[model samples]
Target chain A: MSTIPAELRFAESHEWARQEGDLIVVGISDHAQEALGDVVFVELPEVGKVFAAAGDQAGVVESVKAASDIYSPVAGEVVEVNEALADGPEALNEAPYDSWIFKVKPANAADLGKLLDAAGYKALIGE
Target chain B: MGQRTPLFDLHLALGAKLVDFGGWDMPLHYGSQVEEHHQVRRDCGIFDVSHMHVLDVSGSQAKPWLQHLLANDVGRLQQTGQALYSAMLDTHGGIVDDMIVYQTDEGYRLVVNAATGDKDLAWMNANLAGYDVRIKHRSELAMLAIQGPNARQKIGELVNQERTALIHTLRPFEGQQEGEWFIARTGYTGEDGLEIILPATEACAFFNDMVGAGISPIGLGARDTLRLEAGMNLYGQEIDEQVSPLTSNMAWTVAWMPEDRTFIGRAALEAERVRGITSKLVGLVLEERGVLRAHQVVRIAEVGEGEITSGSFSPTLSKSIALARVPMATADRAEVEIRGKWYPVRVVRPAFVRHGKALI
Candidate 1:
């Protein structure tokens, strides 16, 4: 019974994106966090690391159970990384929506529309 | 469909995430796996280990029958309720299974791993030609492992007066029977705790009572991490049908005394000892942020390639640790490959933490 916020756009891989000015803030969805169990470590991309649309290994999020790759929602260059998660990885488990992993400046702004909306994301997770 | 344990409904009610383990549907975690791990280390937690097989071997030749069945000599268990941990092996010195044998007045009771139940029972039955022992599977029973530093004090408030006195006098690696309940001072988590075997009919009530008393319901996820931190071997991982005790750091569990006495795998083990064991199990600690997982390759430069058997994030130390079987000549340093890149790891004794303290 994980919450899929109506505002946030999502990827099939379980990462969610929210538009924040020129850059979009991204984090794992509630379903992703629940499936990964308690996160013990998070490996975020460097500040300027760029990602492609379909094939990019954005970063790593590791729970006590397993480590999963967080893929990019759309092609973008990482503008900012969440440094607080390095010390307290549990933040993502506590609130997956609020604890953004990294902010990405999209390579093509239209790519955001191609991503799954709230209804589509809910359908993807079978919620 | 997988089988269900007696506590299956209770787990669902507690919001446990159930997974298929071996043929049984069991809990992976109640909610947060890390919280359960910390609870067992810092406070108290209980695990429904009823999936494990319990057998009663009775009759005239029970002692001599077990002597040949297990690698460890059970003759030393002269005192009542004394338990012995031993490995049942095949003729080729391969591990069949590992179990705990407790000597009770009626006969000897053995508790073995759940995944290896059928195979183990088949092996036992195949070797019963000369012995007068009856191997009875106690299907009507359920077991729970109540563990942690404060486990004893918490459980004391729940049981009756006689069982309370019995709990107080219970020593490590021992069991005391009272009516239908058998409480043993043994645990896989390397903590002071009890593994209780009681009638299955009363398991739900007992579980409810313990939870009502604030004992957190633990799942197999934390059970695994706790045992991994304690450096205990998992059946299919560290010591399996193909893995020998000589290389698995379980040679101590095999008794070589009374030279005349021969066990199932003794001959092959003795031959292996003479030839010298090549690969050995050791502990690996990754101080950095990466998580160590099973089957990851370990590169020891001069000693050839080895792999991590079992590994996890150690909640107590907040670092990743693992048990890797490396070359006999390997010492100190090794590198583990994760994804495509290799990272350096330090090798030490197989144990990481025990008794709620960091051993590394």
Candidate 2:
């Protein structure tokens, strides 16, 4: 079974957003990594890049099977990214929750409430 | 929904991530695809290739019927248990399917792709009016490819003493029936190994025995990478109905001897030979960080454009490589467009690794 941290919020697209004080840490869910298979390459957006909403494309993740676009979880600026992922894309596969892709400084931190909770996310994945 | 192979139960029990492959449920990986790729290169690994279609052709006119049906001459397989790699073509020179035909005592056995089974059989049935031959699709058979340097030695210890003694005497690209099993020292990976074909009922038990003997059970995820690293062609990707054998690095397989052998697609191939071959398949090596992939546009300066057919990251070489069909006038250097960005690649022969040694 995929791990769903109760404190974090999730998107239907398999991304999770954990609220940390003011900034929100965003990454793909465990279900997402297992479905993508072995990751061979990763392409992340430049720091300071701005996104209009959670739908914005922030980066790309390519597994041995196929490539998928990583979307932003909230409307914000990309304050920080997991720069270490360039050389070690397998980290995302090892632990998707621990390997946060980027931290977004949302225009309104309350937008995090729009995302689904752990129970809802689990139900969405038919857990 | 898809059909399951004989080893389906074993695969699910081993924690393999199953995927739909040509209407069949097959393992993509047990866990780590990169580690599986390394296992085959360094030691040995077993692949459940039971999804591949096997056809048995036997009759009085089997030899002559195959000579006319295939692009490669079946006349070359004179000795018993010898195998031949040939492409069955349509009248217009399009590739119907690429297959391996083995000359057995009964007649010839053809192992074809699972996706193209129906069309290939239909094509065979349509052309069998004049020739007397019985082609039976052996769906009851399951196949496994035990590949790598130590594959033979490990597999040898599993069978009976009679079969064990025969393994050392077998030659490359050759297989002989031992009771009910057909073992051939041939593989898609550029490594020393054997492809064993046996009845479906006995496959699971034998597979469990091999795995118990410490033979790593590899999945299809690594199979694609291993074949790509070895510069081998995949049926649907590299060789298709739209692509001819001339440009697909299969010219050597076609027979032009005696000037009287009337193989299907010969006239068009001869015509193409007279006109000239414009596109050629070559290997591309990317020394950079980017991974090369299929459908990616290759920018060849002045000589026009091309696209990669098979591409992946080589675990042995520690770099990305690909096989692309480029204009005959193209040179040694080109740039590939990956995710809207262009990267440089070096051109080499369509082979990278052989027997655990790096070629490029």
For lDDT, the strongest prediction is: 1
lDDT of each model, Cα atoms only?
0.91, 0.90
RMSD of each: 1.4, 1.4
Q: On residues A17-74, what C-alpha lDDT tens digit does candidate 1 reach at each position?
A: 9998887888999999988999988988898888866448888999888889999888
Off by over 4 Å in 2: none
User: What TM-score, computed on C-alpha atoms, does each candidate reach?
Assistant: 0.97, 0.97
Candidate 1 backbone collisions, by pair: none
| Candidate that scores best on DockQ | 1
Worst lDDT 10-window in candidate 2 chain B: B161-170
DockQ of all models, two decimals each: 0.79, 0.59
What does DockQ come to for candidate 2?
0.59
User: How many residue pairs clash in all the candidates, one count each?
Assistant: 0, 0
Interface root-mean-square deviation, candidate 1: 0.8
Error of 1 at B254 (Å): 0.7
